[model samples]
Target: MEVDEEENNDSISEEEEDSDREPNPKHCFITNLPDQLLLLILSFLPILDAINTSFLSTRWRYLWTLTTNLDFDQRLIVSPTEDFSKSRRLFASFVDRALLLHEGSEINRLRIWFNYDHELYESHLSSWIRFAILRNVKELDLQLEREWEDNDFYFWDMPFLFNPSVFIRDSVRVLKLCLPGLDPTPDMRFGSITTLHLKQIGLTERTIPDLLNFCPHLENLVLDHVGLYMAPLKIYSVKLKTLSIVNSIQMNGSVEIDAPNLLSFTCIRYLADDYLIKDVSSLVEAVIIFSLSNAFFQNWRKIVNALTHVRSLKVQSWWWMQHLQQTGEYSEEILPHKFRYLELETVLSKMELPGIARILRISPNLETMVLESDMVDQMVYMADNNASEESYTGDYLEKVFTGSPLYLKKLKITSFLATDNEIELVKYLLKYGVALEKIILVPYKTGLVSVSPEHLAERFQELQAFPRSSKDAEILLL
Candidate 1:
């Protein structure tokens, strides 16, 4: 009877154990997905992650092979346990294997970005380029950053070249090549590309003009750090809407542009040179930050007059000539007088005040104004004259106030030393500007003028109480 009871108890225990175990579901949601959808899902992932999905299940084994877009960026790899050398080797091996096993006949886009290595990865990189070109990639973005611990250019003598002629497919729309190697055939052309971005490209005289002659559909062009062996480079494009030249050195000749449909023009990190834009009446914005040269002095007025149609403008001059010659004294209607926003940065000496006054006087429609500069001459002028701040500004401020229509809605001054001259100028603007909305004073910490915070508070009170044309104008002492 005890043996019978033990068998019955064991049977009950087995039944409870069987009930506790849950049955596994037959279908996984991801594996059940359509092949096209799965392939698309794999395309969004990095190649490494895409390949790793093969380990998930049989359905995802070869899903990555159908991926038409390949973007290999080494910077994406991050692992705390693994060192970079190991990660780099694994990254290279995976990309190499994936491309070798890729099933797509044509690539939609192929982008590769990595620091250039000459000894080890040169052939690998070249093979990858050839693979993409052979597969008829429509968009190719190849950016090779030259890793340099010292100052010399690492790629100045490397022989592994990137010839744009390899891109023969008419389906190509956008092509960006960094450190683009040179030597082009006379008749070679990119018939379908609409956007071309070239960086660190050593361009000869015939290269740009010849290239632009064939690329008529190209509307946007950016030349950054381009080593232009030819001076006075002529960039003539009818369809170009946006053109920017930055950190590019041109030795002798002045740049001449004739883009009729251009809507924006920007030149920065370059010294002032003659940039003649004739037919850009549609331009709405312009940014000019140029180093000053003697040639710039002669062409300053012409350059300003050319960009007259732009409504927004920003200008900074590192060097200013004490005496300037006017090639042609243009009337207010002819100059760029339609500026709604203007920012000027300079060394605010007494002499540079006229330049500020000149822009203020001409821009009758200007609504916002920003001024930033170190005040040198204004302080010296007051010290040398031994006159009060009000007396010193009585001449310069009154001239600008009377000569120019006072419609400014906002004003900002940087390096606000709270000196008598500076205060007098602010007072003059507050008193004259009838439609002024706001005035900002950024008290620069030059330590040259020592005004206590209490004194600043008193000045703020005085400015708030000291009446002017615009009663609603607020002052911010920041």
Candidate 2:
């Protein structure tokens, strides 16, 4: 009996030992991943978020140190109640610490946005830039906004801590500078930079040449709200494909572009003596906007003549009718002849129809056209008053509708009031435009006034069904 009891006790002890063993974890907990995979994951995160991930675990504590792209945004750090001075100090310290932590890494890009407290942060900015150069950063974007209180004064004259020449190097491929009305005299040896953007900068004749000379390999150039103090600077870029200049008022100088590979060009509020874009056979699209002035007529002619080969064109001449009326020669001489698509936004009048006709004459193959009238109420009222005078009404409508090139298949008219005269205009389109396939009329619906979609669709059908030669035409309403 004693031997049997001992055997049972031994069996129970073995079972208990087996039950105490724990199951092995299916996946191993790896504290470190391949550096390439870490970078791939970090690339998907915003710079700030990536930096904050350092606190997640000890493994991630210095993961940001391996990141080559650093972006510091003061707007994200500054609170409305925070002291600006303290915020600037903290920003400087954080940048310093991040750079020190990532000392050995190859920094590829650094983007910073901060309020331009020149007196306080100028030296710190210089240090940060030096650090970026030491680490061989390829892309650098610095956007500086001055406080509202400094608006009335000249903030551009603030003493710069670093010479602009020091920042120009072969390692940098993209550089963007947003300064407070300062003309930067960058070194010409920074030919490695492929993209350049300058905002609210003053580019004098000498300064413009200096910049072009420096960025010889630049592929994309953007100048926004920049002033040209001298005659338009001559620009010659063999590698440049995209160029955009916006809200630039100083026009005494003309921009002479000789980029052979240029693909796209956009210019707004650029008043220059001779606007020239030559040998850009690769040009595919262009947008030229001019403020209504007599000087613009010359520039417009120059631009239209250069961009005649463009397939798509957008011409926005705000208040141009008033200027044309005042000048007495209400005709646009330089109109594109080969544009497949055209979008015009301006007030239309009888005097301007000839210009429109001229455009259609040149672009005989135009497939689509959009006409947007600025003053719908006035146009409708005028059409109503002259409804009885068929000659007056017919002539006006003929000038507006037939002026379009004969091949226009799609016509979109927006902001039209359904007054009798406007309706007559629509009728003239239905009667005259032989190749018109689709006509979309969108009535001006604002405030408490509204047009029923059903009513509009019905009226459109009635207009299309009005006794016509062909049954292929369709009218749409919105």
Q: Each candidate's root-mean-square deviation in Å?
A: 12.1, 12.9
lDDT by residue (67-164, candidate 2, tens digit) is: 77788787664454567776666666666665665644567888888876766777878888888888888998888866646554334344554457
State the weakest 10-residue window (summed lDDT) of model 2. 1-10
Query: CA lDDT of 307 in candidate 1?
Result: 88
Candidate 1 residue pairs in backbone clash: 232-253, 271-291
Specify the highest-TM-score model's number. Answer: 2
List runs of model 1 lying over 4 Å from the truth: 1-111, 118-120, 130-139, 147-160, 183-188, 230-232, 271-278, 317-335, 347-351, 372-394, 401-405, 412-428, 439-468, 475-478
Residue pairs clashing in model 2 are 188-214, 231-253, 232-253, 232-254, 251-271
Candidate lDDT values, in order:
0.66, 0.66
Error of 2 at 23 (Å): 21
Cα RMSD of predicted structure 2: 12.9
Alpha carbon deviation, residue 240, candidate 2 (Å): 3.3
Tens digits of per-residue lDDT, candidate 1, 19-99, equal 333323443776778887887777687666675565455555566777888887766633425554554554455456658
